[model samples]
Target: MTEDLEALRSAPVLETERLLLRPFTAEELDAVAAGEAVAHFAHGFPSAEDMDFARESLMAGGYFFTESVYARLAVVEKSTGEVVGTAGFVGPPIDDELEIVGSLAAGRRNRGYAQEAVTALRGVAFRDPAVTGIRASVPEDNAPAEQVLVAAGFVRRGTPGLETEYFLPRPA
Candidate 1:
């Protein structure tokens, strides 16, 4: 685990071929929680659920400011420089296992963006030697989301129910 909590607060900016996963600034998180429009947010971005998550994360001292590898990162589309969604660790590692959550704008789904972001997150989580595994849960009916996890090398860990749990162990 990184000994410096402050260093972890500033998450490294992760870039994929088409997406940029950068930590959300305090100002942006505040604006999101208040339902105010952020300039770079894409249309229909930050849905009610997203807003609630942002508010809750901020209320918990800003997820990024905690000991997690990364906080809530705005998933930006490179071509337009617009935030199409958000993704990050749910909280700091527990038993060397961390949970992650991510979502894209409704209009931007099914273009490989979710998988790309999840893969990047997996990369970040594994970078910390203390993180032995990562996990995610998707509603059973959300086949697309499940597919994204699978594409990112996460395997289903239990029987499907209201939500299906997935896990990815640190690479050898």
Candidate 2:
């Protein structure tokens, strides 16, 4: 278990055709976790809940480690080198399953960034042999996120209510 945790803490950066998924710097994670403004972000976080989520994720990742698989990573636009969003597991996997969460900057939405980021994160999560599947829960009315998850190959797993659950099993 210690070796597994160490490996997770040293996970590599992930990249897609158009985005770079890099771990958040300690300072950046600290700021977001504290609900403080991040200098490089064009627009600040969308809401307090976003900051809360960031904090929770940082805690789950273990503060002071930048490469933990549960760490919230900056979703950078490769061409512009801009941080357009964040992606990460909600926490470490349990029973070979984990939940993924992501958010795009307000101005960066509707651009397919969420789908790209989520897909990249899924790859990262599955690289660990322990991970067998991933899941996501989005508000029932969040059609955009639902579409992004669907495009990333997540299928609805249960009845919809205030929130809908989606799951994606690792490829054979």
Candidate 3:
């Protein structure tokens, strides 16, 4: 609910079995904010124009904080402490329901880091009294992402057709 950038500034790194997620940097924020990283997704990357638009609407609004502020931490390899990619939520709408963590980086896909990252992030998310559920939206054709979420305890709760929705509660 709070959009204070200071709230996320200097946030502690979140640890996982094989990864560490630290707050996103201004450079990384600019890259994502500028749509430079969209080519990595199965879904069409956000265009520079789109990112420019979002810069004002989403970035400026601190949405990445909850709705779209750049509150993400870099996802890194635990053993090497090398950055593998990023993990965290992207929208305020999700915060009001389930804390939705966007998936991991393209290079890091299939490494099971996504699963491990979410597993850890969910623990942190659920620690808050308002959090009740956690959810993710994997493209219908993204088998790897679906596998990661399913393996992490998210089960289908909607129609099996396109855009199917799956959900899981925060660990009690």
> Please, what is the whole-model Cα lDDT of each candidate in the order they appear?
0.81, 0.77, 0.58
Each candidate structure's TM-score, on Cα atoms with residue i matched to residue i, is 0.88, 0.83, 0.67
lDDT of 1 by residue, 84-142 (tens): 98888877788999899988889889899988888888888877778999999888889
Candidate 2 residue-wise lDDT, 1-172, digit = tens:
8986677667458888888888877777677778676666647553465577667656666552346677667777898776667787766787899888888878888887887788778877887888899999999889999998898889999864789999999999
Report backbone clashes per prediction. 0, 0, 12
Query: What TM-score quantifies how close candidate 3 is to the native fold?
Result: 0.67
lDDT of 1: 0.81
Model 3, residue 121: C-alpha shift (Å): 1.0
User: Which model is ahead, 1 or 2, in terms of TM-score?
Assistant: 1
lDDT of 3 by residue, 21-52 (tens): 77655554566566664332223233443344
Question: Residue 1 deviation, candidate 3, in Å?
Answer: 17
Candidate 2's displacement at residue 55, Å, is 3.1
Can you tell me which runs of candidate 2 are displaced by over 4 Å? 1-9, 44-46, 57-61, 64-66, 159-161
- Displacement of residue 94 (Cα, Å) in model 1 is 0.9
**Candidates 1 and 2: which is better by lDDT?**
1
Candidate 1, clashing residue pairs?
A: none
